[model samples]
Target: MNKLNNYKDNEYEYYPICINGQIFNCFSSMSLKDLLLYLNFNLSLVIVEYNKQIIDKEDWSNICLNINDSVEVITITGGG
Candidate 1:
């Protein structure tokens, strides 16, 4: 397991990740949970997708990101 500091210090190059065509680069060493909290996203439920592959949330803490990695975190919004 890489220490949080190990990832925190490196200057990671960012790539834009699109959420419903909204371009935003989420390239960082921060954990997915932290990011979601930062975004203040309604995370009662969320699905993680990386590199067009789906990853289980149970592994979010262990999911270390690399540069250019496209990860999508969609939360359950109020509606039908």
Candidate 2:
């Protein structure tokens, strides 16, 4: 489990999380909605898998992300 710890900056706490196999630093706790907004994802065309489970769009705001949580985001594209 990833735990939040104070960084040298002292102004923020960062937690480590794996998104699509890449490690990212997040400040404080946030919901899936916030994450999507932070990543600039188009909510209407993206699918989110949290901790290996497919999460429904309606539940994004209610789901809180924890340290070390694995998240996979897939963006739908338009093509012929």
Candidate 3:
């Protein structure tokens, strides 16, 4: 597990998370869907694994990110 600086805001909180082996300070109140959008990911072309488990699209919005959470994003590609 990683350590994050505790932060607070009127609307949301901020914390650190590990994404694809990189550490990033992110909003603690953000859902997976929100995080993806914040990172400018093309939602339709990628798959997400949270805490080592594959997450379904429909559950993205329901999963809230917390400090030190692990996330992995895989982009889909096609080649002839």
TM per prediction: 0.55, 0.83, 0.87
Which consecutive 10 residues in model 3 have the weakest lDDT in total? 1-10
The order by descending TM-score is 3, 2, 1
| Candidate 1 C-alpha lDDT tens digits along 1-80 | 11122123256645344443455556566566655666777666888776688877677677655544566776676787
Model 3 TM? 0.87
Off by over 4 Å in 2: 1-9
Q: Candidate 3 at 75: error in angstroms?
A: 0.3
* Model number with the top TM-score: 3
Preferred candidate (lDDT higher): 2 or 3: 3
lDDT of each: 0.59, 0.82, 0.90
lDDT per residue (tens digit) for residues 1-80 in model 3: 65767577798678889999998878777899999999999999999999999999999999999888999999999999
